[model samples]
Target: MGTWNEGAFDNDDASDFIDDLAEAPDWRTVIQMLDHVTKSAGYLEAPEGQMAVAAAAIVAAAVGDVAILPDDRRDLKAALGAPPQGAVALARSALARVVAPASELDELWQEGDDHDAWLTQIAALQTTLSASQ
Candidate 1:
């Protein structure tokens, strides 16, 4: 929950997740992260939400939507080339869950002054992901 700004990767959990992706960059890693949110049964924690957002962003970037991506994370695109089959759909699903009810990430942002901005960021990521579908 150590979020600094509203951008998808502008948080501690997301930064850590990216570092982990750098080690074993692969498509499944992104899917697995997204599944943590899309397949969740109960409340989604902020860290998981953050990681999922980062994962979705990677998928978006892989499919040629790099507008929302940070410069440092862009290199990951080469390490993990084209997104896996159905990745765009999975990313879209995960993003919907991230901003939905019981999502700690969403709830936390709603409590902050920049909630609208945070939401706009997520929406942009979703829009980018959807475009590739």
Candidate 2:
């Protein structure tokens, strides 16, 4: 990374950007990726443990439904079925626990965005996580 010039304002930095976000990559990409994986016969048969969990986390985060375990999805829905809360309530609760807990994510929408900010945020979160744990 290059040192910022002293006059650099917010416009001069790409650190908080995710390049692809500038193009507004949509749910279609996330859905198609999931469709491809799930349509594969062996997709679910991937070995369990850390690797599987990690892959699932990636996919689930992309789809904005990370808190629901793959196998527990049905059970989760059933438990919430016909509850007092409405769909909006359910969605808000899920968002509160989204794997990507980012705000002003649109700030990540910069051309030539190196995504360094995301890496930095993840590192910080990991530190906070370890400290809490």
Clashes of each: 0, 0
Count of clashes in candidate 1: 0
lDDT per residue (tens digit) for residues 1-133 in model 2: 2323211112212212212222443333323333443333331221111122222222333233333223423233333233222322322222222223232221232223644653443333333323322
lDDT top scorer: 1
Residue range 38-131, candidate 1, lDDT tens digits: 9998999989999999998888888866665678767788889888788899999999999989999889888889999988888888878777
Error of 1 at 112 (Å): 0.8
Model 2 CA deviation exceeding 4 Å by range = 1-22, 42-133
Model 1 is weakest, by summed lDDT over 10 consecutive residues, at: 64-73
What local lDDT score does residue 67 receive in model 2, on the 0 to 100 scale? 39
Tell me model 1's lDDT, rounded to 2 decimals.
0.86
Candidate 2 positional error at 79, Å: 30
lDDT for each of the candidates? 0.86, 0.28
Candidate 2 has its poorest 10 consecutive residues by lDDT at 6-15
